[model samples]
Target: MRTSLSVHDLSFTWPDGSTVVTGLDLAIGPGRHGLVGLNGSGKSTLLKLVAGQLTPTTGTVTTAGTLAYLPQDPGSDPRRTIAEVLAIADTLAALSRMEAGDVRESDYDVIGDDWDIAERTAAELGRLGLGHLELDRTVATLSGGELVLLSLAALLLRRPAVLLLDEPTNNLDGEARARLIEAVAGWRGTLLVVSHDRALLNAMDDIAELRGGEVRWYGGGFDAYEAQVAAEQEAAERAVRAAETDVKAQKRDLVESQAKLASHARQGRARAARGDLPRILVGGRKRAAQVTAGRVTGVHQERLAGAASRLDEAEAAVRDDREIRVDLPDTAVPPRREVLLLEGVRPAFGDLELDLDVRGPERIGLTGRNGAGKTSLLRTITGELAPAGGRIEMKVPWRYLPQAMDLLVPELTVAENIARIAPDASETERRSRLARFLFRGRDADQPASTLSGGERLRATLASLLLAEPAPQLLLLDEPTNNLDLPSIRHLVEALRSYEGAFIVVSHDERFLDDLELTRRIQV
Candidate 1:
């Protein structure tokens, strides 16, 4: 296969002297590849480097042909029209002047052989399920899903040899995401996508994982990559077991050797004390016994040291993160408890209404397309957003976690934020609980504004889960929106151990499945 892009010894460092990517080497041929990694693992940064949006601190990037990049959040002037966003405004203006019979020679130069730009733009939009979008429409009037489709339409108009997309489906609804997946399925050029959207990644021709500052390629799509990693982890676990066994055997032998040496020394001393040999011979025997004991102990000690080294080598293969362990509180609810009641409730944002009763530890997934009343419903329940009409009765302590995770006071430290919710908790108790959430020492003291996407969510979770009364009913809205795959996994891991019932709003099918939802509700 011909390589379409290549990176040699690439490295990047932030202006604050923090290193993100270091000495990375990778190559990609003409095929679709999904790039995945943890939240701060530099997937977007690497895409920017390849697209020439950012200069690498070291190493070289080579591209065979024209490249176009779509950022996670495509920015543009709100007043710009669709034609201008597609870079065809000038050509259309010249075409109009030519048709009006007042065209200069420069107008013809601008139009050239690309006079069919208008039809091409319409056709691209139609193919992407956006035929209703007019070329003269301003960007500010579009929805989040529409904006994403508009960006894709712009990229398709250019027809670049290589296309790079970062989180293209972030805010896309079900239909919009499906449209994008269809477009991607028909793509023939070199494409690299970085996303946490599993359904999108599973459509790739191959997969590349950026872990521990390296890219590892796997054949086929997301499912294949998952199986391969599982195998690797299994092998790593087996190696750890064998190494532990060897270390134990070595320790046993060392103990036995020491015991034998002590017993032999006592026997030699008793034999000498009976006056069975002359004084000089007795002294010589004692010296010989000491030398033998040293040699025997040294040999066993060396074997034990070698075993310990082997154990360390074996343990290095595993990728376990014990510090981020999720410890569930003992707050499980009984099956007969009436947790919530929402009767004739109409939330602020959508046209839908709900009359429902939730009981016990139910895992409810509130699913719908973008612009739905999912968030509004959660807010109304929390009394943050009042209902247009109707009533909501909650019999349990409930907390709502919005997508932004702004529950904490940004100016305060994480520990201080926890203290706000759990005023009765001792300072040492707060620190101990925060440590389990991976905030130790100075990390707990770091201001909330400085926290990353994953850390902020963890902090929010800590605040709600460790509240004074201990929330029995939790409501989460798009909790996995900006999180990376590892962060998603961590969230799932934490939720697995949670005894409290929750209602989560999400469009991610894979994530919803992993949560083991007891029921799904449509708004």
Candidate 2:
């Protein structure tokens, strides 16, 4: 079998001297491969190293053919035109000059063999649902989802043999996500994607998990990899149990051996004291008994140590899947309470009139296309943006968790950020509340700028729910964008205990299903 991408003894270290990956080797053949791990497991770093965006500290990355990379955040100049983003502006300009009969020899050279490049670019954009966008339009008018798809389209136009995408579905809506997944499913050559989106991962031919600075390969897609991991965990748990039992038995044997040795020593002392034989004979027996006792105790101690070592190894194999446990009784709204009422409400963005009467703790899933005004509706409801035309009557306190998660002050610690919302709470109280979200001790003191994607989300959630008024109605926008699988699960666990009414805008079908939403409203 031939490999399209290969890494040999690859190692990378930050300038701060912290190593992200070391002695890592991977071989990816011509197939779609999904890369998954925890938030800080270096999946993106590995992808960048392989794509030649970053130089490795040691070792090398070898690619069989041309490579194209779609980064997680494909930042672009807002003033750049669509044609420039698609990388066909020069060729299109050459074609334009030729059509006007003003083409120079350099224009002919620039056009090269891509005579139909404009047509091909248009078709590719149409396939990615960007047909409505004109080539001359600046990217400033496009939504976040549209920008992501445009970046992907640019990569596809290159038609490289090895493609690397890092969280390409972060801001996409359901429709856009489907288009991206379809493209991934039909991809030829070698494609490696770093994503937490289960739907996107399910389209891969294989799964590569980057954990503990190493890459482990598994056959098939996300479901298959999950099943395999679950089985391995079960076996590891059984091993731990068996080793624990062995340790306990060894401890019991050691105690019994010590007791028997003490009894034998006492008997020898008694016989010697009573002059049962000559002093010499008694002394000799006493010395022999002492030696035997020492040997027996040594044997038992060695056995116990061995058992303990084995138990440690067995326990190390088990994974820690601790969930975030929290209860927000104060946020609960009464079943008969009328939480919000929107009558003929039109947002500032798209022309979608929303008329909603949210009662009780209704969990609504908001669905829409890329350019739809779902976020605008949420902002209007939260009074962050005035509605273009109708009335919004909010009977209870409400809070909005924006997709960008800019609620926290970057300079403040996690606890200090929470303090901004809960000013009356003491430092101890703040930390105690933050601990429920898994920010314990030193974690609670971490600066907002230093947090990982998952940690930042958790901290933001903590700040919202722990506010002074205790928000009864919550609006969440794309809450699971860049979170890893465990973090997504943690979010689910936290939401399970939240009693408030929330409208979450997400493209993740699996995540929405897990929420057991009362209703789904398409914007």
Candidate 3:
């Protein structure tokens, strides 16, 4: 197979001298590849190195043909038009000038061979469910999910031989996600995508896992990769058990050897005390016995050390993926208690009208397309934005965890941030609660600015669930965005014990399924 992209001894380190990836080598052929790893495993950093967005500390990256990269944010000026963002504005303008009979040599040069660039761009946008979008439309007018799709459309229009996408399905709605998945499935070039979305990863031809600064390839998609890892983990656990047994046996042998040595020494002492032979003869026998005892003890000690080393290796082979565990009994509402009431509510953005009542510990999921007013309705409920019409009544204390995760104060530590929200919580209480969210000891003291995507989500969740007056009504918007697969599982585990009523805005169907949502509200 021809290698479309290759990395040789690639290494990268931050300005603070913290290493991300070291001595990493990878080769990608012409196929759709999925990159899976825990958060902070340097998946995005490696992609940036491959795309030449960041300089590698050492070694080189080689690409066989043109390359295009779509970063997690894919930031673009809000004022820029779709045409300009797509890199075809000049060609379109030149074509217009030629049509208007004001063509010049410079215009002809700008047009090049992409005379049908406009039609091609439109078709690409349509493929990604952006057919309604106009080239003259400003990016500011698009929703976050729409903007993401628009950026993808721009990339596909270029027809690059190598494409790198970081979390491409993050902000996309169900329809948009399906479209993107279809595009990925149909991609003919070498495509590498870093994503935690199981549906998206399942669309890949192969899976590449980055762990401990090394890349390991799996033969098939996400399910196949998971099966292989599961088998490996099972073997590792068995090895660990066997090693433990061996270590225990070695300890028993060493103890027996020591006991036997003590017995021999006592016998020698008794013989010498009885004057069974000349003093010289007795001394020589004692020395010989001592040497024999030393040799036997040495053999047992060597066996014990070897067993201990094997045990260590076996334990190290097993994965330690910790989970978040917490109890929120205080947040529970009575079966007949009305947690929230929305009466003919009309949000500020979309034209959808809603009348809903959340009672007791109901778990509700909000589903909609981009710009369909899901977030607007959430903001309206929080009173951050006044509803255009109708009334919102909250009978219990409520807290909102926005998609942006803006709850934390960057300069404050995780503990400090939690304290800011729950002032009545004692320091011990704060630390204990944060530990349940997997932030313990110095991790609780680290500044919020230093948190990875998963850590930040955990911190934000701890703040919300640990807040004073104990929120009985919770609102979460896109809670799983940018979180790794393990982080998402952790979030689900944390929520499993939550007894409060919640209405979550998310496009992740898998997450909603995990939550076992009682009702799905379409906005």
Candidate 2 lDDT by residue in tens digits, 58-154: 9999999899999877889999998999899999888998999996999978887889898888888888889999999999878889999999999
What is the alpha-carbon lDDT of model 1 when measured against the actual structure? 0.84
Q: What is the lDDT, from 0 to 100, of the residue 275 in candidate 1?
A: 80
Sliding window of 10 residues with minimal summed lDDT for model 2: 12-21
Model 1 lDDT tens row, 1-523 = 9999999999998654556689999999888999987765788888989999889999999988899999877878889998888889999999998889986999888888778999998888988788887889998767555777788889988888899999888767678789898899789999999988878888999999987789999998888988998899899899999989989999999899899989988987888889888989989988998999899889988988998998898788888653356565655778869999999999876776988788888899988876567777888999999899888999988888876677999889899999999999899989998887778897788778656566788889889888878888999987887677777887888887787788998878878899999999987
Error of 2 at 262 (Å): 1.4
Question: What's the ranking of the predictions by lDDT, best on top?
Answer: 3, 2, 1
Top candidate (TM-score): 3
How do the candidates rank by TM-score, highest first? 3, 2, 1
Which candidate comes out best when scored by lDDT? 3
Better of 1 and 2 by lDDT: 2
Clashing pairs in 2: none
Show model 3 residue runs off by greater than 4 Å.
Answer: 57-59, 411-413, 423-428
Find the 10 residues in a row with the least total lDDT in model 1: 321-330
